[model samples]
Target: MKKTAQPGIEARKNLDFGLDANTPKYWHSNDPFKTRLHDALQSTFPEGERYFIACVRVFNDRIEDPKLQHEVKEFIHQEAQHGMAHTKYNQLLAQQGMPMKRLLAFHKDKTQKDQKRFSPEFNLALTAAFEHFTALLADAYFSNKETTAGMDPKMKALFAWHAIEEMEHRSVAFNVMKSIAKVGYFKRSCAMVYATWMVMYFMFSFADNMLEADGFSKWQRRKMFFKNLNWMYGYKGILSSFTPSLLRYFKPSFHPEEIPVIHNYPDWVKAYDESGNPHKACEALIAAAH
Candidate 1:
């Protein structure tokens, strides 16, 4: 397979997402299902991103390519900022009564154990798989209008910035696994399987917790989960557009750069470059969608 360097990973250091009490309870168009789902995922970002950075850092010194080495450092910087940004947002969720401490502590413990039990190469492979998942999510965010149609401006800006950066550095982990760790096709495929199951488990689990906390009984939560299924898997749903890309990960020759970046990528980047604000970048994206 022909390989290439990822586009530059720019660190937009110390970005403040401006989340607070004024942020609505159901921030995603006042839809409980959508808001809870998004909040659950955002809740995991702090710990999950730290785990991602740790996995990549394990192999940093072993990387021989100058370009990959530099990108790895920038990747760490970006991931750190992502963790910090999400930490602030999660605090807001806690203030709104989301049991942030217990849930995140649970996830933190799980990740720490994972580091001890798994080999560094496997953890890095898993990190690559999770990156692929997030890249798919970034595509979903920008490529599907319904996903962001009525999202809160501050929330939209936060996710848009993260998505653009996800696209920017999507290839870093996979390249490190393939080029630096020399992991084989079987292990790489296996890692995706493990990642898919883990993501589905925790994301839904957290979403379920949110719904339960909102006073839903088990039956109501089950009903809501099924109802929201269409939003995720419907013909034009967020996950619907990217099945092919998800499957492409299992191919022996798969590389993240092969998938087309969102069409609005350049416009968003230009907006941020010109204004030095992610909210402006998000506004540019919304304008382009019209």
Candidate 2:
């Protein structure tokens, strides 16, 4: 394969860059509570990366929309970076004393072994639905800072930039699915329901796995899990707004942009050049993590 870097924001049309890798992130790697969270998340980064990998292949095998392909390429570049950064984060966790072997066995390999649980068509549909959900999650992340006061700034910035990009290209996977899978309303609706469950299931599983690693009591882990979720979500306002959109799932006119855009991005994104150039530094996270 002829590999190349993603063009920077000014160089690439339909794309924006939000990475400042030099940003120092604080982690109390020694805290047993924190390390467990790190381990669960370590698996999350790779699993999500694999989803994007599968997506790129979907474009090659299935997508016929040229415009969307360009967007997919942009999405792939950022996602590859997200994976790499997480891989590095995970390695650091392992270095702090959590083995990725068990981590993978639980989260990494489990998400990979998603064969009998769902069909490819269903999976693809769910991927599309979840893409929208992810954008929402990102939007939620950046919309409020009080909930994020003590967060590692590096992770915060990563999620912020990702939220912006997700808002920027939220429709890629859904567009690809309509062009590729040619799925129906019933399948799409079912996929959304399944997508909700799978996301929740995996997220909780990650927390559970982290709890198991801790030498702390079940009650302590339970308290920490809920505390972290609350701290992360802040009155969990994101959920209240996120679910109402599902009613529009099969409504045809419903779209991602109709949901939210982190109070909307700066108007400057509207006037950017669209040359389709790629950027290297951001994409470097992929191989660097490996």
Candidate 3:
């Protein structure tokens, strides 16, 4: 696999989103199923990202390359910011009566258990697996115009900014794993399978719980399930779109940077720059709305 020049990672602060009562119950494409799916994923971030940071942190002293060490610091900063930002979003979900508290507790407990049961190398491999998942999803978000077309502008910006940054630092954890002598193809592949199963199981489970909490009728719930399933696995769905990239992980020589991203940072730098203050921008937008 030919490697392209990697984008630099920076940990920008003060990112904010316009989340409130006015924000739709189904924020993603105004579809209840999609919205719940995203809500479930957001609920995972607070705990999940911290795990990623910690997994990479375990190997920090072992990494001899100065450049990689710097990237590790930035990766920690970025993941911390991601956790904080998603915590706020998850709070909004709780405020709106979603089952965020219970779901969050479940995720936190799961992470804690994994930390105790898994070796540092396995944990880091899992982190790399998830990073690949996010990078692939980010690529899909940018390539698929319909993905964000019906979203609230502020919410769209929030997710888009995250996708761009995910792509930017996608290789950090993978590289860190590579630096460790014990990490190898077998462990990485097993981690990918385990990570994918766990993520999908939790995500759909939480989505189902959220939909139930929202008071959807039995028939409506049934209808929405198929809709979401079709949207995820049907022809031209996310499963089809991401499968190729996801499969690349099984290859002995696979690397995160090997997967091509559909969008580039230069196109999004103005609105979501590494140095810009998104919090102030969000505040100004809210103030103007009144």
Candidate 4:
């Protein structure tokens, strides 16, 4: 077998995206299925949080790619906020006594291992793939009248906000790869194919792991798992949602705007922020649940 050549990688400046812990969206438990998937997706969160931090760490280590650099900074901004947003929701969920520490630690180790052992191109390639997955989930939440209707408006708003942002920041990682990645076309192609498979596989492993510990009976949990599976499989019909986005990478003329935007949020999410917070009526429901 031929030795695979390592890909070129570069760094970009970190942006100072600050955190505000009291966002309106955090005021209550999101749907249990949605929340479970939240943990599953969030299990991978720190790696992404660190990817940008890593980029910022390495910024001075290599030549800059200007547009890619800005994208990195902005992506980091959104991710940093995402970490905060999810942390709040996850914490409230943790108070349900399903403590996420084990899941968090396990993934943290996996993230570190991947970072040290893999080529930077591989990591960025993986990041791009995961972002595509998130973009779909986010779109589903943002645009689905079914999910959005007749719910706690705050929670509905949370999903919508995340969806728009996912679309907004969709290309950050791959653009960075384009800026500095040096793997040949074959390796790059393999990265996408490999990444797509890896994401589905990871989702399976994550769902299985969470089911074991979420306090559900074997039968009920199995039903929930299938419910999740059905939603995932047809969320936007087949793998077409993912494949279309993935193929764009191969096109020389492909650009971010060419990707479809999923939703126009109701005017309230941005406007809801006097302090970017929800009405205090949420506290009673949350307290009652616990």
Quick one: best lDDT, which candidate?
Answer: 1
- Please, what are the lDDT tens digits per residue for candidate 2 over residues 222-278? 787676554344455445545555555657655555564544344223322222222
Q: What are the RMSD figures for all models against the true structure?
A: 1.6, 8.4, 4.3, 9.0
**In terms of TM-score, which candidate is stronger, 3 or 4?**
3
Give candidate 2 misplaced runs (Cα > 4 Å): 1-42, 59-62, 115-118, 225-241, 245-252, 267-290
TM-score winner, 2 or 4: 2
Cα deviation of 30 in candidate 4 (Å)? 8.9
> Which 10 residues in a row give candidate 1 its minimum summed lDDT?
1-10
Q: Runs in model 3 with CA error above 4 Å?
A: 274-290
Error of 1 at 79 (Å): 0.3
Question: Candidate 3: worst 10 consecutive residues by lDDT?
Answer: 281-290
lDDT of each: 0.85, 0.55, 0.79, 0.53
> What lDDT is obtained when candidate 1 is compared to the true structure?
0.85
Superpose all Cα atoms of candidate 4 onto the true structure and report the RMSD in Å to 1 decimal: 9.0
Residue-level lDDT of model 3, residues 1-290, one tens digit each, is: 77876788878776767666777878778788888888887789879999999899899889999998898898888888888888888888888998787889988999989988999999999999998998787666656556556677767667766776788789989988887636988999999999999889888889889989999877888888886776788876766678888999999988888766554445565444533755433333232221
The sequence of per-residue lDDT tens digits that candidate 4 reaches over residues 87-169 is: 66556545645446776676677667877887776766666656766766654444434543434555544444555566667
Q: What TM-score quantifies how close candidate 4 is to the native fold?
A: 0.69
Per candidate, the number of residue pairs that clash is 0, 6, 0, 2
lDDT of 4 at 285: 21
Score every model by TM-score: 0.96, 0.71, 0.91, 0.69
Q: Supply candidate 2's per-residue lDDT for 31.
A: 43
